[model samples]
Target: GQVEGGRKISSNTEASGRFHTDWLNMIYPRLKLARNLLHSDGVILVSCDDGEVANLRAILNDIFGEENFVAQFVWKARQFTDARANTNISTDHEYIVAYARDDGFSLKGVGRDESKFGNPDGDPRGDWMSRSMLGLATRDQRPNLHYDVVDPLTGRVFPPNASTGWRYSKDKMAELISEGKVLFPRNDDGRPREKKFRSEMRSEFIAFRSIIDGVHTADGTQEIRSLFGVDLFAFPKPTALIASLIEQVAADGDIVLDFFAGSGTTGHALLKQNAAENLKRRYVLVQLPEPLDPSNREQKVASDFCDKLGKPRTIAELTKERLRRSAARIDEENPLFKGDFGFRVFKLASSNIRAWEPVAADLESSLLKNAEHLVQGRKEQDVLYELLLKLGLDLCVPIETKSIAGKSVNSIGGGALIVCLADGLSKDVVERLASGIVTWRTALAPAVDTRVVFKDSGFADDVAKTNMAAILSQNGITDVRSL
Candidate 1:
């Protein structure tokens, strides 16, 4: 549902519950991070029950701002039992709160079925539909709509009902009549209607259903049961529901990020939906490998399931397994699908740069070891990805490398970032390499400023490093740094 007036209103959370203050504290910064990660047109949906819904909304308001509050979707799931609650009423419904990153956020509207529209009159424009031109408000509510529409051809006046007046003002009615798009009835009692043309429809699609219907919490458990042959995760969000949400906000080529990747339903749904529709929607799912103990009642099934699959016993492990199984299922169902769905897992690690830990007795030796810069067994790809994270470049951004003076130089983000981590750069090759980079940068013509990074230890001596920086600086490529 759309926010009323699309206006910024001050959120009144003074009376919100304090029971979940600790939960709110942890989620506040994460919401801010999610906002920063969103695309220009991206949106976020958070799920909660009645107990903490108000508190969750309050923090979401504080982080995303009250103005960006989009909707609070009601997922009406039938509660088989709510015996734990002391209240008289059973809590059968849950809420999914949504917020936009900016003003550009909008859900994809559903298109109107054209079967109802036809060119019965055969107008030159296109198929036309006659619609009632009556306003929903009373004469008191909209005084302007309570006006007379005179048929000039017959010179007869038709007055609107006081309870429901004409849809448009007198001036607009006159304009429509002049344009021959208004239908005046011959009978004195019949109301006038609008000749809306198929070609002139304001928009092709209408608002999608606001209420979540049919789907239930049991459906989620059943879906996992169907896939795993046992209920591995309890109350997992249904892939169908997540797919519907993804379809509404994310178009082709859009990215969906789920920081709390529970069961990887978001990724699973995105993959299945995108493959079915041949869309290029991508996703980034961040799930911590929370340890799961097989002996623990809550996690026993999932942890045992992970063990049977010969994987680590963690929620994140199962999340990845869910995605893999979902993709394999999609491939089996659609053998000719061109296999456009897949994901790579990247683990969080410390920076590849070797830190210098100097003891007073071993200061000189520590300096010598630090001279190497990169840690032992660290690959170039690891360092390259670390550079991407530090630079805030998209991890999926295009990266290409070229041989310059027998050394591989990498170009990233269409040359916005240039890197050369090759070792053993001599003064003789520095000029040639720098010159080649300058020539390539000219060809790239990136829309933004370029930053060049090199391995500090790669240079043979200080003179080689100075010469490389000097050559790049002289050619309007001054932003240079060493690893």
Candidate 2:
């Protein structure tokens, strides 16, 4: 369900004079929560266009600390020209704002793509790569790096370029020569350079600037169209771009969450990267279940496209279908690459139980109406999920429900969450709940010091609250929260 005034207040309309302040406040809390959710070494990459990039950066600096700011990646989203537009400048790029959880967080030792390494000359050490030995500094600026490189085969020495200097000092060059890292050209006419063995290089390194080229936006679109025979999404980012970002920020087994899962492209990218690297990276994608608009021609095209591919009509349907196809492709290309594309689905809804009150003549009808309002259109399971999110619990936490004293008492995350979705929480129910805490602690084998959280509205009387608290305190339940 959408929060009505919540949106207006969050977006900060003209009615809210402190629009900028409101916007920052709205995002600040979420970021703070996100920071808590992330691992100590985790990094967050937030994608935004020019519209709010500046504001996002400033707020990120304030929230995550200026020292934790990572590189801002600039991505080219499109290649087509828009000269027909009134504005002379055509915007086709976007930014990915990156920040670390702490100063210790770094991107070093991340795996690099094997395709980037190649060996023209077969070396004993295996695939070797050549890199320029010239530094960007001018010879005049860095005289220490300016030196002559002698071709031992031709007995000739070459002077450093006037514009650029050698990358190493004379002593360092001599050390590299003794170590056999410097490669003299076979022709004896070309400049000498340094050789980097693939085996010697670190598997991971810091990510470069965000400006990505070479991979076309059309490449992603074509990949989807090739599988489905028509554009499944308006614009999808190339797998390479997403893979690069993932490799730089995410660890092998970390869970990546994408709440704005448009067309499920991020899932596909994650799966592809994991398969290629033999890493097990799990992904959770959340998308609004927006229905297809039949009257729109674009919708018609998508519908016909799905028909052509012998698939379902809706976007979510096609998203799963594409994931299956990608998994199949990975399996075909590399038998060793095991692809996992399974996911559990969930939907949000309201609470299941009602706040109890006495059924007196003045309150009877209101109590009945409120009970109906609580459980009429929503399921108990959906309410439980909503509470979990509201309580800042991980979505993947396990939940177990059992009938206790004719009421559904849910033990979530091993009794960290104790919920009762019953019509009226009576004195007997509270007593049972208090006893169940001990049962759950034993069942889950958690430390005797486990916390318990209950719905504030579940208590029927002051005695029930006192008994529950006293029982919990006796059992060493030191932490408790209500919602």
TM-score of 2: 0.66
Q: Least lDDT summed over 10 consecutive residues: which range in candidate 1?
A: 1-10
Residue ranges of candidate 1 with Cα displaced over 4 Å: 1-18, 79-88, 120-125, 129-135, 138-140, 143-195, 356-362, 369-372, 376-381, 390-394, 397-483
> Candidate 2, after superposition: displacement of residue 130 in Å?
4.1
In candidate 2, clashing pairs total 3
Question: Per-residue alpha-carbon lDDT of model 1 for 196-308, expressed as tens digits?
Answer: 88888889887877678677778888878878888888788888888988888998888888888988889888988887787888989988777788888988989889889
Q: For candidate 2, what is the lDDT? A: 0.73
Clashes of each: 0, 3
Q: Which stretches of candidate 2 lie over 4 Å from their true place?
A: 1-33, 79-92, 108-130, 151-155, 178-180, 186-189, 197-209, 226-229, 289-340, 356-374, 383-483
lDDT of each: 0.85, 0.73
